[model samples]
Target: MPEALAILQKYWQHDTFRSLQKEIIDSVLSGHDTFALMPTGGGKSICFQVPALMNEGICLVVSPLVALMKDQVANLQNRGIKGIALTGGIKQDEIIDLLDNCQYGNYKFLYVSPERLQSDWILDRIKNLSINLITIDEAHCVSQWGHDFRPAYLKISELKKHFPKIPFLALTATATPRVKEDIITELGMHNPVQFEKSFARKNIAYMVFEVEDKLFKIEQILKKNPQPSIIYVRNRKSCLEISSQLQTLGFKATFYHGGLTSREKDKNMQLWMEEKAQVIVATNAFGMGIDKPNVKTVIHIQLPENIENYYQEAGRSGRNGEKAFAVLLTSPSDSIQAESQFINVLPDKAFLMSMYNKLCNYLQIAYGEGINEEFTFNLNHFCHKYGFPTLKTYNAIQFLDGQGIITFLKEFSEKITLQFLIPSKEVIRYTSLNPNDEEIILTILRTYPGIYEIQAAFNLPLIAKKSHHSEAEILAVLHKLNEKGIIDYHSKNNDAVLIFNEIREDERTINKVSKHLIRQNELKKEQLQSVLNYVAEKNTCKSKMILNYFGEKATTNCGICSYCITQAKPKKDFSTLSNKIMALLQNEDLSSREIQNKTKNTADDVIFVLQQLLEDNFLIIQNNNKYTLKT
Candidate 1:
């Protein structure tokens, strides 16, 4: 073990293991099923990585996020470790070659998405490989009790049967006690070690602002703290608009959402990380794998779906163990809009079925006929063709996705649409001179007939099948032509790529939509509303409200919250210091330190009385800072 630690340090440059990382790794090394619940930044990867190196056979890691796995694999390779990942984007031959490498080469780790577990070839390959350990990242997806539940995860539990004796390590960041049990039962782990970490962060000061003018409140937050911050919005267009608005306000800001191209998203993120952009106006897509430790604030413009997401996102701040603020800017109008959006989200089964059927018709396929078919389902194009509200209809489709009807990550897949930019005679002349590639030239001509006069890029896979070459080989040939100025190809690979915005399902069939699923979504909206309510019903300690949401039994008021600081302390004798202060600023928000300076009292004494007044519901904080007597 000491030798193992020394090697880990020498290779990875980490001095020691984080909390429970050693225990989890040791359990797996001893061939025990391990269920690890490490908080974000608790170092979950090392738990599997160390044992994987010590194990006799390849460690197969089943994951959900393909881009994250790829990033990790790239980092591993940088550290001289051989790791491979299998996702939908990779060609079948490429995946086969990777599996072969695991079996024959010195590869010790293989990361694959849970969706790939559905493939017959993948299961067969796993049965053949000397796979000794299986690690499930984000294992909460397998449990219906979890917040981010996915039906594809159900397929992963079956892997236990394929390699009966292989040690299984299930890991997640945020799971309730119920979710924890569901993970254990779903994975059939016996007496697994439960390494639960506290969700509490003393360094983060949770503040909920009750504001009619959220923009004004945002301006105040920036003016007061003005450090590197993340502004989380709900939609893609909002990301752009908000970032633009912030830029207009003289703050260096950039937007990041799931909808952007991989290059654009990565560029924006790197800019933010490098401080080229001091503030990131992002949707929920900004924080994963973010190592910036000094993010001073995380401001939510609307609301998150649940506390788990809120906590994780907010936790991105104060990672450097410095004081940070997690603020929520909520309004009654925002709440109404959020609720309205939720209510309008349920898709009628018949409508969904009709849409799916239309999609199949457009793609020229029968029911269940296009099993592995992939297409660019442009919402604007589809909505234009069908005459439906693009946003609302698309959200309904997303709801269907949430119902386990389909796999939808809400991102785009960049694919090749090969169209020739020249005449057939010209192409033939070029191919004649380039006879070494006559096969691809002839293949393209045979597959995409009249490509020289085409408008749309021909489907590479469709062309590949017609050409009798693998997708990669076909792509390579196309790339050469593109490089030689004969054709053009586009690659749209992105981490936050949408798998299936809505799976091609029989939408017309009336099925029991999981109330559990809807409830999960509803919880997210409710979480947002809670922040709204906290801000609106001010004079309460904002940090205290946030802590309670994470199931903290403590009710001790966070006196430092905007609400507590603004509202004057209530009079104990019906004529105390709070009463006098309230009389002075009856309809205003008072800065606590400023008020303290005026009152000539200690911070604690002022906070205590203000908190008492807030508890007594004597006043409410509003807008940016001050408080008003409750009517």
Candidate 2:
């Protein structure tokens, strides 16, 4: 503990640990398998990072989120600690080199994707490393019952057979009792020390507004709250549209989604993080790896698919432990749309196999030939070419990915690659002949090494700055170089990466995986229903509802959420107000406020009774907006 604290102070500049962080770190340092159930922004990374600093060997971290892994690796490097993240879109030799560094470079941390565990070459290299600990981030993905289940995570248990003595620490921000048990069993944890922090974020005020105009409600909330906010929508088009609308409303806003290019994603996210953009209207892809501590509000324009997703996204607010608001603006149409988008249209077994075949065909993979091959997948193009519905096709692809038959990733930042076809000397000679392109060639050489040996990723802006050329000019030079056979270039970014784990198969082989899809659909329906129930529930505190859903017992109401606030407000005796309103209408027509003043009732009570009377047809409002009793 003393050593861990010293390292933390040195690296993080913190004097003490957050809730349960010290305990979890101590458990790992004591060489015991540990499972930590922390809410979002609970500092789960610190639990393993501190212990890894105390240990003698590298800590192998298996994660499902590429952005998070990269962010953490960058953070560790910033702290002058030796760490590396081996993600997708890199050459095999690059991974080998990185693993070699871990083996002999005395690196303290190694972040790896779960899918990479299936490669025998990777496993062989990992077995040779001096691994003292294994940390699994997003451990909930190991269970089929998890909202973001990934079958690649199941292969992590195989490591237990190889590194039996090394302790395993599994961490997730969201998990239920079932997922918890499944994680423990599937990971082959032995007498694991379980640390579950309270899922309740008392600092957050949960509010659900059933409003007809979601945009107007969002506007009202933004106007009331301070800046540094996130507005989550369901689709990419809405992300852009809402952001544009917010800009028109005079708020500095940006948009983000899975479909955006890497450059756009980075720029918009950086703008929001640096406080240059006060609000970011985005899809669910916006929250991961983002640690803006002062986010005051997280408004959901549409219902999330499940409670887990909703809770995670909503929990992104108030992370700084300050008071914040999580407002859900819903319309009557939103419920039906959310259900159809998430649950009712889930592809069945037949559709699953058919989609699988179509995907294989789209990639043009012959039977038993395309194992471990990855392709840049465009879902819309595939759907258009094959006459498949976009929603069902997406769900079907998700199911196949969960079955380990393939790997689908939406985040790939390895665009703008260049590889030299000739030697550097030859390239220099050609650049001398074409002096106009000399600066770009030299800039590429200086910015990224190993371009001659392999395709190297480069930033266009950095290269342009160094070369004193515009991005278009740099691209033109790169294209010229490629045409001249001096270098090979591939640009025009692809957003998705699809890897086929096995070759194309017949219906029988596909059916084996599709059978599980049925059960998966059922589980999804249950999860959707849970979300619907949470939104429809009015008697329970939103915090309590969330806590109870995660199997935590809340002893008292939060006293600040929308439900609690509504309950605490004295329930006005509307009976007297209703009688007064009816009597007043019988005598003469009056406006709502006039009726309230004449009856000596509260304004809210008067409005409630008036609305009820109007709904019941006992009173009618004229063009002048005065209520009168029906004839």
Best by TM-score: 2
- How high is the lDDT of residue 191 in model 2? 99
Taking the tens digit of each residue's C-alpha lDDT, what string does model 1 give over 219-337? 76888887788999988888988889888998889989877866688889988989988889888877767878889999998866666787788888888889888887765467677
Lowest lDDT sum, 10 consecutive residues, model 2, at 209-218
lDDT against true structure, model 2: 0.86
Off by over 4 Å in 1: 1-4, 348-351, 396-552, 555-560, 563-631
- The Cα error of candidate 2 at residue 28, in Å, is 1.1
Clashing pairs in 2: none
**Global lDDT of each candidate:** 0.72, 0.86
TM-score of each: 0.74, 0.83
Report the error of model 2 at residue 517, Å: 1.5
